[model samples]
Target: MEFVERYNGSGLLIEVEKILYEFKGVQHIQIFQTKSFGKMLVLDGKIQLTEKDESFYHEMLVHPAMLMHENPEKVLVIGGGDGGAVREVLKHDPKEVVMVEIDENVVKACKEYIGIDRGALEDPRVKVLFEDGLEFVKSCKDKFDVIIVDGTDPNPISQALISSEFYRDCAKICDYFVTQSQSPFAQPDYFKSIYKNARFKNKAVYLGFVPTYPHGLWSYLIASDRREIVLDLNVIKERFENRKIETVYYTPEVHISAFALPRWIVNLIS
Candidate 1:
């Protein structure tokens, strides 16, 4: 019956029906009901996702790299405990999806209160592993067609994932790797670190809108040493039509346009 607010600079406040779950383990985690956004998930006092516009973030994070490849059969998802990233990956009908999440509590809380995941975690094609993502990437022997990192911001806990060491290992194992790179406008320096530290031969950054996150705009990076990810617009469009997937935000045009960086981002990354 009260409102919880996320304190950044100006911050965001949401009226909650009730706090469904809240705990302090490794980090603080909470899930609560909201009227406009449906249910919301918070991690370490940061708003992770709200039910209303999560599709924008999830679709953009998943589809661009996925379509960049011809047929991505084997995929890896790291740290998206809410399962939104996993759900998007399922649309392509990949042979297998290996998900490694650092926090099991986040998954459990999202599973119970927030249904944004739309039940993709239980899909037979997915294998869920609760472990440290950086360690998992270092040790994984299997090569994947695509690797998507849906982790938190680059803090001490997530710094290793955005580190050059992790990026090198990921490049060696996967044909393509994509990860959240923070908002281009809000955390430009941090975003630059994550985007630049990858050091891959062929890397590209894309932009999307995530209303619940800081600045209402977010950026993501796709990195690979295999070859340039650029494909013809027609080819991307054909893939979209052939897959017959229903998406809320990302389309072939949007996929092509995501790489059309804003001038500010162009300057930031340059």
Candidate 2:
């Protein structure tokens, strides 16, 4: 059967070529393909990633804050079972990468089907933990230089991850952090709330395009306890050159532009 997903009353319909895998775990996980997007991961009828443009989302989510950090040796990732984010983090050659995901099935399924991970989960620097992300962050005592929250939308099941308490817990563990905030074009109110709740020493919102997602636009909220973790185009360019990192969609120029929000959205959040 041809698969179709309606974007939660957004009046957008996404059609799939076939259902590669569909099963119940914490949520309904579906893997499928489309002519435009290659392979895709869908959870609870929401599009997560497409192989064609996954790098844009993953790199935008992981890199800017990571480059800002003087030395992000140890990292924590919450809810990125697909390992795309970890794959990007590994490029920085961090000493350790710990990923806490509630669903082992998603990890296994992605490992088997999604080529985006490129065997990142098996890399020596990564440690995958099957546990609730909220509890994991609260209980973890060891600190990290960077923490990435690659969580889904703030539904009933995952709402706690977007709460002020959860941000507090994250702040306790990392000097710098980033999260996959929803599209400011699609869910500006929700995005504003998440940004306001994250009362860090330094905070900024950056965006990238995710063609398969609701609006083809994704925003990430980056926060740092360190005041010097500001975005400077020249510094970011230098960092990229020093690391010799190659990316498909992210560049220092793009990084600088992503923060230039529309005046109304800025006022709304302000």
Candidate 3:
């Protein structure tokens, strides 16, 4: 059986599948059927982004801040080339949504193939910039109400995005900073380093879990200059209950439940 797709100019490959329907949407984007990870979206057709259970990743990234802030207007998203993060951020109806995605191909593929992003690119309020996120943060003079760092794993290329310096830069440009820290179960050292770095730069540091990612669980770190790290569970629940938008995964109950970490896991961080 062929394991690779015919190469397309935009970095996409088409693959013939037996058990799973595999297709390369772009140079870095591969979609496949999987038993555990669900329909997986692989970058460079290599790293997995989502499975069938995508709501877990999307909800954990977006709702915590949406509920935490009284009202968020200017929102900045870094490295969310797939647009899943942007889709969730838009629920708040922010005045401006700026996405700094280093790879324009990822955004193009996601818009053309990924159903989850659901036309987030077409929103008039969104401004897409094809540039390095780290540089964008460094040069940004205006601060944002919320900044979500939806970056990939810490390979050499992504190392700067997860470094202490990056978090410091983010602190300067954002009121609230939320990022997908490496999964504690898979890359505890990486997560610890980022957590410690974030704690050193920002006042509030908190963690949340998403279940769809590798190890059937994932972690995210939240840092803010002024606000406490805890999500207002009551407020989030109320917002979900009153929400007019159709949602697949996030609810008031799920919002509160995701934050409930096991004592062992909490102790590991402490």
In terms of TM-score, which candidate is strongest?
1
Question: Which candidate order results from sorting by TM-score in descending order?
Answer: 1, 2, 3
Per-candidate TM equals 0.96, 0.95, 0.82
Candidate achieving higher lDDT, 1 or 2:
1
RMSD of each: 1.5, 1.5, 5.9
Highest lDDT, which number? 1
lDDT of each: 0.87, 0.85, 0.70
Cα RMSD, model 1: 1.5
Q: How many backbone clashes does candidate 1 have?
A: 0
* Ten contiguous residues minimizing lDDT sum, candidate 3: 5-14
Pairs of colliding residues, candidate 2: none
lDDT for each residue of candidate 2 in 85-169, tens digit (9 for 90 to 100): 9999988889999999988989989988886789899998889999988898889989999999998878766788888889988
Residues 124-215 of candidate 1: C-alpha lDDT, one tens digit per residue:
99999989988988988999999999988776677789899999989989999999999877787888899778999999998898888886
- For candidate 3, the TM-score is 0.82
What does candidate 3's lDDT look like per residue over 135-247, in tens digits?
Answer: 98888898899999888777655778878788888887777888888767666787777777785334433344454444556777777876666666687766655555456
Candidate 3 regions off by >4 Å? 1-28, 33-39, 44-46, 200-212, 242-245
Error of 2 at 2 (Å): 4.8
